[model samples]
Target: MFKMLNQMLNRTLQRVSLFLLSVILMACAGTQSPNQVTVTGGTIEGSLTPQLAVFKGIPFAAPPVGDLRWRPPQPVTPWQGVKQTTDYGNDCMQLPFPSDAAPLGKTPAEDCLYANVWAPKDADGTTPVLVWIYGGGFVNGGSSPEVYDGSKFAQQGVVFVSFNYRLGRFGFFAHPALTDEAQENGDMLGNYAYMDQIAALKWVHNNISSFGGDPDNVTIMGESAGGGSVLAMMQAEQARGLFDRAIIMSGGGRSLFGDRKVSEATQESLSGEQYGLNYAEKHGITGTDAEALAALRALDAETVVDGLNLAAMFNPAQTNKPTWAGGPMQDGELITQTISDALQQGNLADVDVMVGATSMDIGGNPFKDKDALFASFGEYAEQARKVYDPSGQAPFQVVGYAVGQDRTMQEPARYIAEQMTSHGQQAYYYRFGTVAQSSDNPGAPHASDIPFFFDTVAEKYGDALTQQDQAAASAIHQYIVSFAKTGKPVSDNAAQWQVFAPEQSNMLNMTRNGDMQHGTDPWKARLDVVKAAVESSN
Candidate 1:
């Protein structure tokens, strides 16, 4: 009987030990150093800093390499174990700029279909999400720059995301053979970069809730090419309902996908299918059939990029001719029509939009001679000269800069806002005029508003930042955060931002005074003449 009692006591002790061990494990898991979250494909383990939880290099799509080089982004295969997402992935392949000036990561490769996310550590899955698209004229750029760090946004209760897409020739190339093959497979072709973006959006929509983000409340924002991309995605049929709002900075409306009229009229132009055939022929990869595609794909990525002249790709004057190529084709599938055409036809996504440009976005005018520049306006030349070169003594460069700013950035942005507001959609407009504190700095130049918008002034300008700069950044950042959370950009400290209407063209002009105020349209007559000139040309 004593032996039996001792055996029972031993069994009881074992049960107690097992229960205590499970309790210890539960407590330890509650305080684990790194955080783990399961997404669509698999579970991801991310690092936790003092400020935010950062998950980098998470694959949203399979790598576009080898036979998949020019195809639409494919889904990532599911994985079994937890994946450690610690560092950034490779940036999209492109020619390198100076290291100090380069906005890309250390390595750039074709296998670069990854995204990064930043979220508050204590988030409970209801935070608003902001997905950023970087701009390198659609030929370069990635999500790896220091200025693009999302810690600030995360601290303000936002889940920030950035991703890498195919760039340059790899992103936008098209050919007849490829189109034929796509038709056989019941797939659309061209605009692979945009396709990659759509895939990323779908991924985010499916998996963002795991990162404490609300899939229903997403804001898509971009500058320059990225800004244009916002418009593109808004019009893309495949991207419907992916985002609820958009922020476009320095993005052109009519010229977003190249001169649509020109591309359509000029059979041997930069953006159509003929241009693709010409590109293949230029590289001695002849034939308009499957063999040509085999030859084109056989050539390595570097060889394809090496054969093209970088200068011609960037210079509008050069590309205006039939010899050079351009990015973002007007293929009927991905980009059915231009942004202007889409907006006019009421085919855009019905989402709230905030659009703006800096004071001096494109530098001085592109024309060399004053007479030639004004003469392009034909009957409106006299009025243009009076409005743009009012002094008649202002240097051609100064006049050109003013005209270029109006033509390229300011006018296009205002036109988009006008169109949106006219359609009974909420639209907001602003003019970013906050110049950095430096003797060399002119008025806010192209892309200057980026640091301010991202609240990375200190990271970009370091010791040169003034208190006023910091305040401006804070105000702008707060405005964006408010917009992301609520449809309207309402902040306690900021002036009440008015919705843009066709009758009253008021803008929230951001100046160095650390105060944002409403102002009337400054270049009404100039933009009117500019718009007339563009319409007449078309």
Candidate 2:
């Protein structure tokens, strides 16, 4: 009897041990990981890599569809359970550009007001935040491009964020009926794209703390149209206090229209309201009433986009008449004045800025031939040719392109830096001239510095990436990261960045030999002529 009792007791003890082990495992599984965060909408769980915790496709606002079309972004609808933000949401609605440098990862759709985040796995409330705004001429870019991945930034102890805004017609449409609706509700009119950008920044200001980012240390950065948006944000009354530092890459600081008509009903360019009416009439929908708006909203998203993108906008055959609003205009509440006007008046946000452009960039007055282009400079024509086409043997297209670069990109970058410096704010200017080893281009073309700034040259060049490219990317990326951490940009791998001053005209140039050189701008004399021509015209 004693032996039988002993066997039964042993079995009971073994069962109890197994049960205790199972309970411990279940408890561990129930504990929430750092990857799961509670935001304004609800609890969201993100996927984890070895070095970072990444969250994508978090809705920052309601879908601008149906009745909400052409209106300011609305608050996101709250959810009941943990939302899995593992994959990227759709990019803003538009036809994809065929030769785009940064291709979209997800399909384009109207419901694309989503925000993404990349934070250190062990992030603890002290990391600085960097918000990225993409550029496709205000028409074609998105946050889902692989080259825009912020893993390296996260690994460097910073929280990186990117969000999608409306693009093309879907982003910048205006009409008589829409204006009526806006006025009735006291809503701001036109420039809905800027409104979306402001909304996303507001969302970051409110929610980034939960992701272990310091809300007070936010930096906004963009390239091209995105850079233009940053300039607008600096002067926008509603956008004040939203960001502390800004980086403008190839965003023109001078007036875009130059002596051309900007917002009057003219054969060259129609006002936003007139352009909207023209678009509505073409769609077989006319009138300035609620019914007209309903019909406009009822149109399919694809129809509204109407095959618009960066290329289509510039194609003369497609854009003989103004179809879209052309982009952001003076919407009194948001954009009170032109960016150049704001800078001249010193009516801008008190924040430090880092502005720059590629060696070869896009810009120039519209002219039929090189002769006409040079003549636009009036008495400065000979000086222009002397600096731009000194050989006098270059092709018309080459001279035109270089002239455009000076007026639109190179000079404007220097102008913005000069203005910010005058405002008693620290300004840093750079000129990226390092030609990628895989390319045969004469100089760094427009938007080519994006991958380097984000430290994703490997993704950009793939197997063709060279050691020189890697070194260039590392140096530029370090400057950006250092800028985000502290207002001053310092790179241990490169030379010390000096503050820009009118007298010194100091700038950091990423040379073709893959060296970072700090000195006066190489094209200061050329830029001075361009500046004089622009000033005379204005």
Candidate 3:
């Protein structure tokens, strides 16, 4: 009897121990620990915060280094075990700027082709996806900026994503040898940056579903150069059907690949191949095609970047001239034509679009001399002065500011919207004019709407955010969130945002007072004059 009793006691203890171990394992699984998800390359582990399951530094493509430099992005090799994705990847190589004094997380590098994702902790593969592209005139900018945090969007049920791409000389450099090699491979040349973007989108399409995102409903959005990239992607044949919606904030509507202006004249612009030759010659890299390419490839990455003079490349004084030799190229296969030509020909991606610019984009005046400003208009100088400097008493600085804004951003954005609407596609237009209350800001300058749209005013400005600022940010944020989810921008607190139509030309203007109103095109007359002058040029 004693032996039987001991056996029963041992069995009960064993069962109890097993139950406790199972409970412990279950508790650990439910706790705030690292989470795992499998992507194309392999399984990746990310950490969970209160709001989001964050995954960073996941390789979307192999590092574009060594022989891979200047070549199209290649597929990432699969890895063995779960890859830790707790940190942001290297930023694409760029010169440091004052605006970006504080680094996002990691250092910049040539091997920077990774992407990051932010999804709700409880995501179940049915959330909308938003992929952001940063803007730095195609010469600078990265996806690791702190202001671009995706937690807000993730908290609102969005799977937010961002990635790094090649930039500057590395991104757009075109050499005869490279072109020849591409021809040998029967591949497209130039515009490698756009190729990188497409690769990321392809990755998202294939893998986002694993993160509880709806791959079929992807929205591509960007600011400035990023916005321009969005426009370029809309016209890219390779990017078709990759995204269902697009938001182009502060993107211009001019031709990207060629020098064709939105004006009536059709002029030949510098070809990407020719530009590459010029860049190579300027760098004293003279020799046979193979020798020149070898010399370029042998140079240190920092040396190449430091040698570039972006100030001169993007000199606003050089109007109608190519800004930089290494921007989006007109490689026939990838970027066949400019956005202007594509839209007129009705060859753009048949997707819904939201396009707008800040009230004071390209903030400062481009022209210092009043005579030079009027001279640009040629025959329409008198009319231009009358419209731009209506009072004749206004300062030249103010006059120049208006002219720059009208020509560069406002008109181009409106033109894009008009074209999209005319083609029977849904188009929404907005003008973000809400000025921050913290500083004595000069109107809503370029990129001012970013924080507001992301609903990150507090994160960016800290204690400076006023009650009014918060309200405006919330309204704009919800509008964008609604657009990403439902294909239409709706805000519970703001007025109904009307669809853009050529006849109505209605725009949702976020006023400086934090009120949203349906307003007519305030700059129509000025833009008409600017448009006429541009068309008359050359």
TM-score of each: 0.89, 0.92, 0.88
Clashes per model (N, Cα, C within 3 A): 3, 1, 1
- In Å, residue 536's CA in model 2 sits off its true spot by 1.7
lDDT of 2 by residue, 280-372 (tens): 888999888989989999999888878778887777345455667778877667777778888988989999999999997886557888789
Model 1 stretches astray by more than 4 angstroms: 1-34, 99-102, 259-271, 307-312, 315-324, 363-368, 512-514, 536-538
> Candidate 1 or 2, higher lDDT?
2
The positional error of residue 431 in candidate 3, measured at the CA in angstroms, is 1.0
What tens-digit string does per-residue lDDT give for candidate 3 at 72-155?
999999999679999999998877554541234667789999999999977787889999998877777788877788888999
Q: Give me the runs in candidate 2 sitting further than 4 Å from their true place.
A: 1-31, 257-268, 318-321, 368-370
Query: How big is the positional error of residue 7 in model 2, measured in Å on the Cα after superposition?
Result: 13
lDDT of every model, 2 decimals: 0.81, 0.88, 0.82
Q: Is 1 or 3 the stronger prediction by TM-score?
A: 1
Worst 10 residues of 1 by lDDT: 316-325
Go through the candidates in order and give the C-alpha RMSD of each one to the true structure: 4.7, 3.7, 5.0
**Per-residue lDDT of model 1, residues 165-265, tens digit only:** 88878887777788887888776677889999999999999999988899999999999888999899999989999999999998888766754321344
Which whole-number lDDT from 0 to 100 does residue 175 have in model 2?
83
